[model samples]
Target chain A: MRIGLIGTGNVATILGRKITAAGHEVVQVYGRSAIHAQQLAAELQAAYTTDMDHLDPHADLYIIAVADAAIASVAASLPLQDKLVVHTAGSVSKEVLKVASTRYGIFYPLQSLRKEMEQLPDIPLLIDANTPDDLALLRDLALSLSTQVGVASDEQRLKLHVAAVMVSNFTNHLYTLAERYCQAEGADFSLLHPLIVQVAERLQYMSPQDAQTGPAIRYDTPTIEKHMALLEQHGEMKELYAWFTKSIQKQAASGEL
Target chain B: MRIGLIGTGNVATILGRKITAAGHEVVQVYGRSAIHAQQLAAELQAAYTTDMDHLDPHADLYIIAVADAAIASVAASLPLQDKLVVHTAGSVSKEVLKVASTRYGIFYPLQSLRKEMEQLPDIPLLIDANTPDDLALLRDLALSLSTQVGVASDEQRLKLHVAAVMVSNFTNHLYTLAERYCQAEGADFSLLHPLIVQVAERLQYMSPQDAQTGPAIRYDTPTIEKHMALLEQHGEMKELYAWFTKSIQKQAASGEL
Candidate 1:
């Protein structure tokens, strides 16, 4: 498929390269920033465009890989009529692209992507479309790039997005707080790296509840008190630590484990 | 060096096997439960004893791997006089073992251990001692089992323990909540597995703050509100989402990132 790549952010850059590698020709790279558009276009050996009105209508599919707030505006500006158009935003609805083209869908890659990553990480693609043919086309395009592909409605995709935030964003935030705490205490944060890896690795074989361990689940009040006392200097981290500890204890008390 | 393994829980079982694999003799396994002690002893090819007074006196090092609350009591029951004794509890001080033996130290493996794990994960061992010679001896024993060894004071080890709970236990709990959310939505929880792995893998190369990406960091109010609405039925998760979102926004506002 000939693709018109929209935006030149992390998602666009990474997915543009992936689409090109998957044997789809990215005919044009579009960005508000001329430098980024030109750079990505040069990398893909494609045309570059900063004007939304000048998006290559010759391309079979147009992918809007911009921020959630910009997806609808970008779709509204696109000049395509019958060409299949899609936005890569997880929270945005597929109907946002209806104004852009009759044949519209979604090609949301459910992963934390960064263009600076040396190698492509495994991305699970969640797709949706207004029509069966468009859905199949997006599915085929997505399957070419990722083995884990699913057809999800706007609601389902949003739910998964919430879950993704918990697992990726919120979990990483916990790490950030821990790193800060370690730095303050003059302890090496890297020492906990193995434990982090092992905990995540265990999820492949066991459920997270089964994989859960530490003072929280054990309800070791002494250890918990000690930890709370140590975090007195970090107000936000202290509150978060208390919140998470209570949540764990609540789960345990409910006999869910 | 001959070792006396105390407690037959996950830590004791794993460390016992690793010690034997590293060519140290596990002369005896002691536990309050005879069945557990006998089972672990059989696996390590060591003698089993339910009575703490009957523990092997010839063992060079006695490792107390038990619950944090039980460590002090267990140490008090041990018969060792001048032999080097260490309690593997991270929060427990080296002084806890002073009653059990003249030579006391800490040999805390800073990793989440489970007996059912098919392979031994890389465990960063944190060692501490009351005397210089005993510290050297503990360090040698720790080095045999793990390449990452450090001499940490009691306070430092406790701080690391707090951080370990954040990265491993609290992170896993986030996964647990996400899994629950996915289940409620009738979405496949495993779909987020790659995302979880990628977020953690990136931590090896980048700090968590640098790697953070989501509606929270972006302060994307519309998306955050949508997520909060979706999580309306999940009171605990809804509260957590709001808390984390605010925390991330606060961090961003502070120009920490």
Candidate 2:
């Protein structure tokens, strides 16, 4: 399967490399920067194009792996019609690609990507298409890069994106705040490393609700009040601490967790 | 070392088992219930006593592994003096043990413990002592059970407890909420597993601030608003989603992350 990739960022670079490594041909790479396109295309042994019109008209799939905001304009400017085109944004609607081709879909990979990563972890692909044939094509392409693939509607994808934010971005922010708090107290933050890893590993064998621990889940008011008092100087974290504490308590009370 | 353990809960049971397995003699086990203490003592091949006056008077260290609320009462009731005593509560001050013995300290393990765990992971023991001799004794005992051990002040331990709450308890709650949201939307919650594991794995190689990715970190207002609108029906999660989003934006703006 020949593929044309439209972007030169982390997702585009990582996905393009993985697709090529999986024995698919990344036939053309397009980016706003000619040099970046050339560099990535050179690595993938694919042709390079800075202009949208110069994208290979013959590739089997055109993947617009650009920024979410640029997807619509990139789709509109593309020269393809009645051909498979997909955008990789998790939050973007599949209809954004409709202006580029009659057969459009989403080939969203639900994992964070970084250029410095030595190797990619398992990426779950969430695919959606306008037609059965296109859906099949996207599924096959996703399976080539990942064993985990599923069809998702725009609503499902948006919810998944929100979940991703909660687990990844928001979770990481908490870690960041924790590290800062440790530094403020002149405590060794590294002591928390094994604890953090253990918590994550615990999820493999148990539901998150069952995995929950600490003062909030137990509703130990004295401990919670003590922590609140300690956080009085930490304005950002204090409010967040209270809000999360209340949410956990509410979940416990509702028995939905 | 002849060790006397107090309490029969998860922490006491697990820690007692590990200490005995590490070649220390669990001289006696004491709990509120005679049967419970006997059961734990039998597992450790040690003596059992429920009466506070009957605690092993000659044990090298008396570890009070009871609930945080019971620590003070248990400490006051103990007949030991000028012998090393320690409590395993993270938030409690070491002074709680002063009534039991002048030689008192803390033996707080940083990881969440459960009775079902077959073997403990790397438990980072945070030790605090009233004297250098007692500190060395506590450190040696900690090292016997874990490779990771550090001395932490009461203030530092409280801060660490706060950090642990943010990273472990709060993070797990977020996962719980995400799974619930997935269920409500009829989306496959299992699809988020790989992403969750990937986010955790990334932290092993980089700092959390560097690891943050998603609309929250990027401050994608349109995506944030869309997510907020999707979460209108989920009152608890809606507020949490908004708070986390604002926190991420603030972190990014302050450049502290």
Candidate 3:
């Protein structure tokens, strides 16, 4: 399959490499910045473009893997010439590209991407097209790249995006907070590594409800108080510690845990 | 080593089984409740005592694996006769057992222990005693059960305990939130399983700082707002999402992440 890859960002670069490795042609690379586009094109032995006016519909597919907000703008500007176009976004709708082309869809790869790192996870590829014909083409393309590919509507994708943020993005922030408190107390944050691994690993074999363990889960008020007092020096920890303990206890009482 | 397992609670029963498995004798199982003491003793094939006054610490090592409050009272009731007595608690100070005998310490296992579970983790044990001899004794006993052992002071164990809450208990609560929201949306919570596993796997090769990803670290405000608004429907998630996100951004700004 001939592919026109847009946005020489982390996702584009990683996916482009994978596509090229999988014996598919990355015919061109497009970016807001010409230099970034050219670098990726040179690596993939493809053409480069900075202007949407220069877009060639000669390629079988145009993949817009830019930021969520920027995706619609880029898709809107592209001179699609009736080519099948798709954006690798979890949140954006397929309608964003309706004006730019006769055939449009979303081709989202569900995993965090890093430019320098080469972690090609066997992630789920969610594909959605404006029309049935476009969906078939996108499904074929998705299947070539991954076994865990499925066709989902915009609403389903949006729901998934919400779930992804809750589990991945939001969870990482919680981790960052814990790290801060640990550092402030002159504690070795590495001590938490096993626990992190344990939580993640156990969830595979057990439900979160069954795997739950803590002061609040066990209803150990004395231990909870000791933990709060331990965080007395750090103001933020003190507040968060109190709040989370209450939340857990509340959840426990409500049969949420 | 001969063992005197005190407080026939969840942790005590689990530890007693492990001790007996390692060919150590659990000569005495003490608890305030007779049924509890007898059940544990029957399980471990050890003797049971309901009366604290009738307690005889005949084993080489006395393991105080009970609740935080009972640690002191149980220790005060014990007639150690110069035997090594250690409590398996994170926040509890080793000084409590001084009332029982001069030869006492803390044998804190840094993992969640459920009585009904069969597969026990090779937990990292934190050993601390008043004297070098007691420390050696405690470390050796910990080593006999599992090789992952550390000799830490009260301060060190406390530090690890804080990290434990962050990674295990607190993180698990976040899992509960994710599961609840997913269920509310009539979505399968299993969708987040792969994401959870990926996050944990990444930590094995990269430190938490380097492994950090998502909207908060990228400072994607629009995505953050959308997530918060979605979480707004659930009071707990909204508050937690706000607190965790704001905390992450602040930490990133302060060069913590």
Best by DockQ: 1
Please compute and give the TM-score of the first chain of candidate 2 against the native first chain. Answer: 0.95
Clash pairs (backbone) in predicted model 3: none
Give the lDDT of residue A227 in candidate 2: 96
The C-alpha lDDT values of all candidates are 0.90, 0.87, 0.78
Screening candidate 1 with a backbone cut-off below 3 angstroms (N, C-alpha, C), the clashing residue pairs are none
Model-by-model DockQ, in order: 0.87, 0.75, 0.50
List the pairs of residues colliding in candidate 2: none
Chain A TM-scores, one per candidate? 0.97, 0.95, 0.91
> Please, what are the lDDT tens digits per residue for candidate 3 over residues B1-257?
87888887767877887788888899888887889999899988888888766766467888988888778987887877588889998888898889988788888878766675656665677889899987887778888987678877887787778768767777787788778877887665676676777776676566556666667777877877777766667888778767767777777788753
Best TM-score goes to which candidate? 1
Clash totals in order: 0, 0, 0
How many pairs in model 1 have backbone atoms within 3 A of each other, for residues 3 or more apart or on separate chains, i.e. clashes? 0
Q: Tell the DockQ for candidate 2.
A: 0.75
lDDT at A217, model 1: 89
TM-score of chain B of each: 0.97, 0.93, 0.92
Over the stretch A98-191, how does candidate 3's per-residue lDDT look in tens digits? 8779988899877766666647766678899888988888888788887777777876776667777767765666566677776776666665
In the range B1-257, model 2's lDDT, one tens digit per residue, is 89999999888988998898899999999998988888998999999987888887899999999878889999999888798999998899999899998899999999888776766777899999999999999999999999889898998899899988888888888889888988888888777787777777777788888877788777678888898999888887888888788878888888773
Error of 3 at A169 (Å): 2.2
| lDDT (Cα, tens digit) per residue for candidate 1, span B64-172 | 9999999999888887889888989888788988788898999999999988898988999999999999999888889999989999999999999989988998899
